[model samples]
Target: MKFPTVRHCWTAFLLLLASGLSAKEVPPPPDPPRLVNDFVGLLSRTESQALENKLVAYDDSTSTQIAIVIERSLEGDDIFDYSFRLAEAWGIGRKGKDNGILIYIAFEDRQIWIQTGSGAEGFLPDVMAKRIIDNIIVPAFRQQAYFQGLDRATDAIMQLGSGEFEPEGLGKKKISAARVIFFIVLLIVLFILLSRMGGGGGGGYYRGGRYDRGGGWIWWG
Candidate 1:
């Protein structure tokens, strides 16, 4: 009787890996009852209603959909993957526009993710999303101000979606321009130094090769 071949063993290992991955796939929660689904009871009834109303009005006016989901835990699944699957399953945005945003919070895992539809990515980019998480949400959550965090973060998202506010990076273009100017100036200075060093009398001369003058070696081309 011949033992299992290496190829057979490798194929068996791949199958086991696939089975493990399938086991870890967690099903998304049920369809959202409203724009805000706080399954963990993180928000009070009044707070949820107020947020829901605000989101409803925004959606009604702009037709851009934003949904918030707060789960007790992600059930040992990756938050990004779970959020992407959830957003896909829920069909959160308009069909053609694909302008949807899903703010997912895994309370027990202490992980939060913002999944934006293709159309919405232009307005709410990864940098802006990171800013919202770091500057607004995380700070408020750290102080146990979950409602405040969500409220402010959603407000920012709405402002971006509605074109009421520009992302912080917009202003950074000026800084980048200034840096370009600085880099140009630096290059000019380097060119001047190189010219002066290579221009003087017999001290330095270009011979289409490397030259050493007891000070240092310089390549001349």
Candidate 2:
């Protein structure tokens, strides 16, 4: 019986290895930055009429998510009020080495307004809010795309928000441990397979080449 030629055998083995690897799934990328405007703070900064007007413009007559609440004063160490639980807040609020981005919003003169957190206050000055309305939000609104405008505006804001480094201490260590475990498992599996393929009563490759138990011959140098 003629088994596959040497070159064909090597080619087939490589193909099999490639096919096996292709079955593995790739992990997804991280989520994009989110927009988390503190509603209470926003209202305190702007007039209610103007805030409502802006909402109508942004929401295109559907601004339900934006809530208007009567905020009571909270001390320096007080519970956060009217703060939405945005997914991005995990990476935002009190960012480790990475300073957090806290967008403060409140009613000012009965209008909806926002103030970037102290850390980010310098970058996204309240003064820029006017430009944001003119350049970003207004354009999105004019196109009759409120949600899309929010995304565009927030994305642009986040672009400005980035650049601060955030180091996850214990969290980073945990991730490292996970990678170590994965590598150990992979090594263990590879060694187990190699051992089964050799050091057993079977035909397998060795230091120099395969050992043919039946033939008991060094097939070729």
Candidate 3:
């Protein structure tokens, strides 16, 4: 076979180089299913519903968007880099405000990233994001309580956006249903005690020879 000319060889080399450069490949684009996208099925239906409600409500009120993504793997990409790429590709926050928040979880890599938009950066700085992961998320992930971790972390993030969250309170661990129920019961008991103490002073404890206002012995005593 005859050898190729210099111009032909140069063209072939350039083409090959261009193809190799293109083949290097960028991160994949994001196609979010909804406000909460659980690709890995980490969240049950109920958990998903709870997060959706919280996110929807926050968005409705503040026009700030938040989304969750759970993936089995990041396809060998770094989670932090993948998170930024996904957030940018998804166009999550408002165009002008840039108030979007992304909660990205890669279970296979045991990595979590809280990606915030320009508006959110004021509330959720990189330092705060790391703290949320370390204090709120990693502990629950360690215990396999992904739902609790996400729920509380979302709440804390929302509180941050609202400017009501105290950095000192980050130390508080996840609150359990049982603890909530106990708090409700304790409040109810306190309310009853206060009501009994009031004892309807308009009419004395004993009126018209009957306990008109305070029927209980404790109230009278």
TM-score of each: 0.69, 0.28, 0.62
Q: Residue by residue across 125-204, what tens digits does model 2's lDDT show?
A: 44453345445555554565444544454444444445332222201134588898999999999999988887748665
Best by TM-score: 1
Candidate 1 differs from the real structure by a C-alpha RMSD in angstroms, to one decimal, of: 16.4
Regions of candidate 2 where Cα sits further than 4 Å from its true position: 1-92, 95-112, 162-221
lDDT of 1 by residue, 13-68 (tens): 56446546652354454555578888899999999999989988887898888889
lDDT of 1: 0.71
Off by over 4 Å in 1: 1-19, 22-32, 166-173, 176-178, 184-221
Evaluated at residue 205, the lDDT of candidate 2 is 50
Q: What is the lDDT of residue 141 in candidate 2?
A: 45
Instruction: Give lDDT for model 3.
Output: 0.69
- Residue by residue across 49-105, what tens digits does model 3's lDDT show? 889988988888998888888887766554544565577667778777878888888
Ranking by TM-score: 1, 3, 2
